[model samples]
Target: MAGLSSRSAVAIHALAMLANRREGSLTSAEIADSLESNPVMVRRVLGRLRDADLVWSTEGRGGGWSLARPPRNITLYDAYVAVEEGRIFSRHTRPPSGACEVGRNIGDLLDAEFQSAERALEERLDRTTVADLLQRILAADKEPADH
Candidate 1:
């Protein structure tokens, strides 16, 4: 099945890290280190977050990124919309040739399905905040030793 863009996942992970921090911001390098991902890729995702106003960047020696607001104020849907470019699934870019009846009807049918699915997805995401995910992450981190 098709899935959310990896950028959405990275945005969530990066936001969770920020939410977990008690003080100070994390540079792109630090976030990249945590994700074990390329720093450039992390920066790009962070840039998108910044553009969306979900994150704010600081300048200078100790400069880095931080949430624009409290984690609880930011829902997963916010991040998803910011990074997903407003589309859950890719759509037909070019019109189908006037050749087949199925081709004429398929796009509309699939588009309706996609819209319904996207709405449900957004509704669920709206109920989940960055703080909620951070809590889950923290709990998971503590679970191994408890087991």
Candidate 2:
């Protein structure tokens, strides 16, 4: 299964939290508390998001972080790309040994397949905005308990 990097997930969570509480900015410490993680890690992820223009940070005691734009304008794909270091999926080494005919071509074939899959994932993510995600989460929270 393809799993999101923790940094990517943390960044998204932090931005979504800010979107939900748009009245004011939130410190990395406040975000870390809600995420059950360390403030340093939160700051690191926030730094990446800031570089991506997905979020903005301010300095000083009262300063904190906030989304650069409305949540509806941001997509999960945006968050994913912000923290991705390299190819989403990468081969550890050249695929099979060159001794066999199939071995030499396998890597190319696999690379094409990986690229296609990544494109599809990006398309799907583009259709989903942070606003959509937050709405779904809030809806689930409001569901009546089964007694």
Best model number under lDDT: 1
Q: Candidate 2, residues 16-64: lDDT per residue as tens digits? A: 8998985879999999999999999999999988999999988998899
lDDT of 2: 0.86
In Å, residue 44's CA in model 1 sits off its true spot by 1.2
Model 1: ten consecutive residues of lowest lDDT = 84-93
Per-residue error (Å), model 2, residue 120: 1.1
Number of backbone clashes in candidate 1: 0
Best by TM-score: 2
How does model 2 score by TM-score? 0.90
The window of 10 residues in a row where model 2 has the poorest summed lDDT is 86-95
